[model samples]
Target: MKIIVTYDVKQILTEESRASYLDEWQKEHASLLRECDHLQFEMKRLQKKRPSDQKWIADQFDKEIRTRSERMSFLDFKMDQLDQLTLGAEIHDGEIQSIQEVQMGDEWHGREQKGKIVVKDGIVQSIVPDSKGKDIMI
Candidate 1:
């Protein structure tokens, strides 16, 4: 029997474009690496001369390091979020026009293993296995 699979092709395209933009922005901001390196070097230098360093100097170093680290972390988080959203597009393009049937031990979007894809309202509803079935309703 053919299985129903639903998905928003447009949404997938939009996500793909967003991911590309984010990736481009990350590449353009490659200077972040240099800034991180500089901050690390400065911190090490100050640490070695801690005895002669002023309190304000250490505080400023800490602040700068924290800010830089947070920015990097935020960017990483955004990238990961986009990746998850666009995972469907990564599997296959176009659309699942036919009732795509899946067998056991089959992989969907590089996922663990086998199941039948269930689509509803032009979106993925669930992926249930023929034997040990589980609805991935979303």
Candidate 2:
């Protein structure tokens, strides 16, 4: 008797199983939120100082506050994107004739030979040349 088994790559890469990634990003987002709060508080305190002192320090505080505020907004946007993000996948048409025909530790080839897809944190980061060093167009 011959038996064939298939693995669903998509099912294996779903978001539920990848919650740790989101958790990590959330921690960074929280830190940014704290930094933003601190910057705002410092700006408010600077506003109540003597006019001469404020003149000397307000410009620096304003610049720092704006930079941190922008960074916080970007972090929030990134967290939102992560919440809606999905892993990419590609389905190739190929087949293994039989278990006996399959070689152990052999590279699997699709219809066309191409570069490898780099995946990091469930995201398609980049694609570089394969062993043959052939460029694969996206």
Candidate 3:
């Protein structure tokens, strides 16, 4: 006979961990939110100038404004997802307790494509290839 046992685990976040995550989230979210707000304001400003501007210029501005608005909406959706993840992490105290392995996919930005330094306890342990496929040894 095969049997499996499971135990409930309580995840607790240390003050440092909580602060780190909260600060990181706030910094990123605020930047994106600010950009979205700016894009929205620019769109409105452009719309107001439409009637007085040259036809070609007006059309171009309108197209750009619409594009910006669409991008802003997408950013808003991303921010909402981040908010949900933050809430979940807080509830779990940042402790991922489940033993199940999961495959995760991520997009790598240019900055992350280069090698990155991993620092733990204020000490640099090693330099590793970032989220990209390149490998770097420290």
On TM-score, the leading prediction is 2
Candidate 1 structure quality by residue, lDDT tens digits, 8-100: 223333554665647765874466666878987887787778857756677887788778778877777766766676444433323433356
Off by over 4 Å in 1: 1-16, 28-30, 46-51, 86-138
Question: Is 1 or 2 the stronger prediction by TM-score?
Answer: 2
Candidate 2 TM-score, C-alpha based? 0.46
> What's each prediction's TM-score?
0.42, 0.46, 0.33
Query: lDDT score of model 2?
Result: 0.53
Best by lDDT: 1
Off by over 4 Å in 2: 1-18, 44-51, 89-117, 120-138
- Provide the overall lDDT of each model, using Cα atoms, as 2-decimal numbers: 0.58, 0.53, 0.47
Backbone clashes in each candidate structure, one number apiece?
Answer: 1, 0, 0
Q: Give the Å error, residue 105, model 1.
A: 67
Give lDDT for model 1: 0.58
Error of 2 at 45 (Å): 4.7
Better of 1 and 2 by lDDT: 1
Where's the lowest-lDDT run of ten residues in candidate 1? 89-98
Of the candidates numbered 1 and 3, which has the greater lDDT value?
A: 1
